[model samples]
Target: MAKYKTLIFILEGSLLNEKVAEQNALRQTLKLTGREYGPTERIQYKSLQEKTKLLGFDERIKLTLQEFFKNDWISAKGAFDNQLQKQDQLNKDVLPFLDEVKNKVNLILLTKEKKDVASYRMQNTELINYFSAVYFKDDFACKFPNKKVLTTILQQQNLTPATCLVIGTNLVDEIQGAENANLDSLWLAPKKVKMPISPRPTLHLNKLSDLLFYLELS
Candidate 1:
């Protein structure tokens, strides 16, 4: 008998396309605001969206209305969250890898999103079926960087500490969480910046495709 080889891939960050969309939006906001307002923050966009909703300017005039009211962090965060929710589905490029490695990999979405919201988004993206298990924030009553949360998941699934991997964008959270759980960790650093401090990952990957290579060579 062989021990179960569980290769879990954790997904984070809103769709890459949405990030581009955000940049375009920020440029538009600068033009509308008549002055570039620092870096575009999600919280600001979300708050603006919320204010737009409360004002009831109608969708047709929302942009003009936003220009008049000025942008704020809360409004931006609200807008960003709303848009992000729609785009927060599974990544397309990752599908090919998941399909190729289905036999060996057990993809799990360990996210901070609540179960209902995360499930709906995953289902909409048509990516829910690929995962062996789904872990949500409510399931643990705690977020990443919490060792007890990962430990509980492993304990429930009877997983060996050494056979698991936690992958995510935020270095401190995902890498630290995996380390605290006593599991192998993969840090996806797209920006290619050196980690600020200690608690480094078992592996550093610049792209999702790199994960396949790392697993193959490791």
Candidate 2:
């Protein structure tokens, strides 16, 4: 067994290289919809969520939409599920690297995905081999930044926070969740978002290419 019991990796969606992702999503969505909605006109994942409160859509459909963005789906049943494109290049970083390191890691994917939608997306992308487990909010009683959910994972995995590292793009939620769980944290700010000086990540990185180097893992 390695010194670390398991290397639990959490990937934040939207994009690792966020700008290209936004552009790609907008371009693809517009092309698919055949509507000239400017990229800026589309609301963000959070905003579209709030939109459900006003516009009347079926509750089930709205819930699916909310889950769709985080999971990075093109569409469900050929209907546009989300106007978001995952950065194609981010996958390039993982496939080659994960293939090499997977034996040394017990990979688990934690995301805000609802239901098993992300699992479906991962299968479509053929990326399911990269993870041992795929967890979504519906499986747990709570969501991120809520210690109860982290506690659930900890208990289920028989893991201590000291032996784990939480990796993600968002600082306030992801990193803070790790901190609250007493785990080491990695903030992947590939877009160069300004991280505050206080409560900084144990490791801060600009690219997934630099991940192995920063972690000092084989």
- TM-score of each candidate structure, all chains considered together: 0.68, 0.66
**What value does the lDDT take at residue 119 in candidate 1?**
66
Q: Residue 65 in candidate 1 has what lDDT?
A: 33
- Name the regions of candidate 2 deviating beyond 4 angstroms: 1-5, 14-22, 27-81, 85-90, 214-218
For candidate 1, the lDDT comes to: 0.59
User: Residue-wise lDDT of candidate 1 within 56-81, one digit each (tens)?
Assistant: 11231355334434556445545544
How many pairs of residues collide in model 2? 0
Put down candidate 2 lDDT per residue, 84-125, tens digits, no spaces.
323333444666667766767677778665645555445445
For each candidate in turn, give its C-alpha RMSD to the true structure in angstroms. 9.1, 7.7
- Cα error, candidate 2, residue 211 (Å): 2.9
lDDT of each: 0.59, 0.57
